[model samples]
Target: MSIITTERLCKYFKGKKALDNLNLEIPKGIIFGYLGPNGAGKTTTIRVLLNLAKPTGGTAYILGEDIRKSRNYLRKVGFLPDVPNFYNFFTAREFLSFIADITDIENPKKRIEETLELVGLRNEKSRIGTYSRGMKQRLGLAQALLSDPELLILDEPTSSLDPQGRKEVLDLIYSLKSTKTVFFSTHILSDVERICDRIGILKEGRLLLEDSIENIKKRYWKRRILIEVDDLEKFLERIKESLKPNSVEVKNSSVVIEVLDIQYTLKEIPKIVVQDGLLLEKLEILEPSLEDIFLEVTSGA
Candidate 1:
């Protein structure tokens, strides 16, 4: 069963639409990346799913139950917002303890210790105000996990961190796949590529594309073969005479051939090069990166 599902979900503010007939389904035990540029309504969709905002139209469900009808499903979910606020005076242990009490979690002390360890804050004894941005983010994640939720929703969880901090958080997020379903929204395409199992791209309050990383690459991206030879001109002529690629261009010291049929090109290029007596220095097929795909899809280019 889908852990989360939305049907023609719509949300409008005054006359502006934040979401327009957005339909989505996230299955269990996958890191689902919600991707879009700024103001693409990713956060709006998340808010609607969490029942933090009333959708102007349509429906949404979590754990097979409608959020509008019952908020009980919230107990099974955990959320980490883009910018998490904490009581500056409270230590990490104290703050989490406070959250546990409010949420009525049983065995709060044991849960807090386990969660802190999970986020790599087991030894942190300083106040929240003294912590770095990365530490604070980790602490926020610890609070989210205190409930031992089945579904974890995060909004741009690594937006402001440095490279090391991003790595830390990403590693922690990746570790959740065995135990939780993660649905995170981010404009960081590389992060999506690194950890996401499936992704949805939103643009102008609408879903532009949604697919697994591999399938999306195969479906939307063209394969370009980059070949470096002893002589660029000779190889270009050989390519023209033998392969007849859709497009061919000399880039720096190499020739890049764009082909419609990857299998045919791969099979035929080596034979042509060998026959023409051209020295092959490097032969590689360049697959389009997630960043490339995101720009092309969102820009409609």
Candidate 2:
């Protein structure tokens, strides 16, 4: 069953359309990735889904209930916003304790300790203000996990972190999938490629694409041939002889060659190089990376 669903969801601010007929369905136990560049409605969609802001049109349901009318439905959800705010005077422990109490979590003390440990903040003895950005992020994650909620919504959870801090957060998020559904929204395309089972790409407030990461790559990402040679001029001439016209673009000794048919390209490559008597420094099949796809999709918008 889908833990979250939106049908033709739309949101607008003044005269701007933040979201336009957006549709999303996230199944339980999947690490769903919501990806888009800034102002693409990723956050707006999240806000509407979480009931933080009402949608201007359409409807959304979370955990099988209408979010707009059911305030109690929020109890089963946990969220970490892009910039999580906390009481600077409160200690990490105290902040989590406060959340537990407010949420009416059973066994609040044990839950707080477990959540802190889960986020690897169990040993950090500092007030919220004293913590580093990474540490604060961990604390925020601990609070989100305190109730062991069924659905976890995170927006840019790893953004602005150092490499080590990013890894720690990614590791923690990866570990939570066995027990809860994760709806992760981020512009970090690589993170989505690494952790998401399914991804929804939103652009200009519409879902441009959604599929398993592998399938998306297979469908939208094409394999191309990269040829780095010692003889730039000769290689170009040789490619012109038998290859499709205008299929290659050269930059010095390297050329970006779009492989029309993988098998045919591989077969013809060696012949073309040999015909030119050029020494191939490197000949590789380049699959589209997430960065490549992100650029291709968003650049035109």
Candidate 3:
């Protein structure tokens, strides 16, 4: 079942369209990366889903409930904004206790303790004002998860942290894949590749593409092959005749070939290598990064 679904959901500001007929469906138990460049109305989409702002055109459904008709879905959603606000004076435990009280969470004490520990903030005794940005972010996540919501909507959860901090948060997020449907919205390509199972690319408020990462790669795979061998010159000259590449170039010790048909080229390359008695070091397709595919779809180039 889809935890989040949108049907031509749109939003506008002034005379400009922030979102234009964006239809998206995020299935359950996957980390769905909502990818877009800056000023692509990512946050605007979140706001409307959360009922912070109303849609100008079409509507959305969260956890099978039409957002236009129901506010009940809000209770099952956990939100951690780009920059989470906290009471500066409250310590980690104190702050979470406050949140639990307001949300009326059952067995608040046990839940708070479990959440703090889960986010690695259990032993922290310093007030929120004394925490680093990474710590603060984790704390924000703790609060979000305190309710043990079925769906999580995170906005750029690791954009500002150092490498270690980012890793900590990412590992924590990846661990939750079995239990929660994560709508992780971000511009960070690498993080999405690292943790997301599927991605939805949005540009100018319109969803350009939405699919599993593996499927998208196949759909937009760049037709290029990378081959490294000890005998680069002989391998290159022989492979050209055998594979009939559209174009080929020698970069350092590897032959980068552009192929009209990648699968056919792949099979033919190995045959040529063995026939010529050339030692094959590495031979593989040059995989396209998410950023590459993102630009390809969004720019229409």
Best by TM-score: 1
RMSD values for the candidates in order, in angstroms, are 1.4, 1.9, 1.9
lDDT score, candidate 1:
0.91
| TM-scores for every predicted model | 0.96, 0.92, 0.93
Better of 2 and 3 by lDDT: 3
lDDT of 2 at 169: 90
Candidate 1 worst ten-residue window by lDDT: 234-243
Q: 134-192, model 3: which lDDT tens digit per residue?
A: 89999989998999999999999999889998999999999999999999999999999
TM-score of 2: 0.92
Model 1 Cα RMSD, 1 decimal = 1.4
Residues 77-194 of candidate 2 have per-residue lDDT tens digits of: 9999898889999988899988988999999888888888888888877778888888878887888888889999998999978998898899889988899999999999889988
Candidate 3, which ten residues in sequence have the lowest lDDT sum? 236-245
Winner on TM-score between 1 and 2 is 1
Clash numbers, per candidate: 0, 0, 0
Clashing pairs in model 1, backbone N/Cα/C closer than 3 A: none
Give the candidates in order of TM-score, highest first: 1, 3, 2
The number of clashing residue pairs in model 1 is 0
CA shift at 208, candidate 1, in angstroms? Answer: 0.7
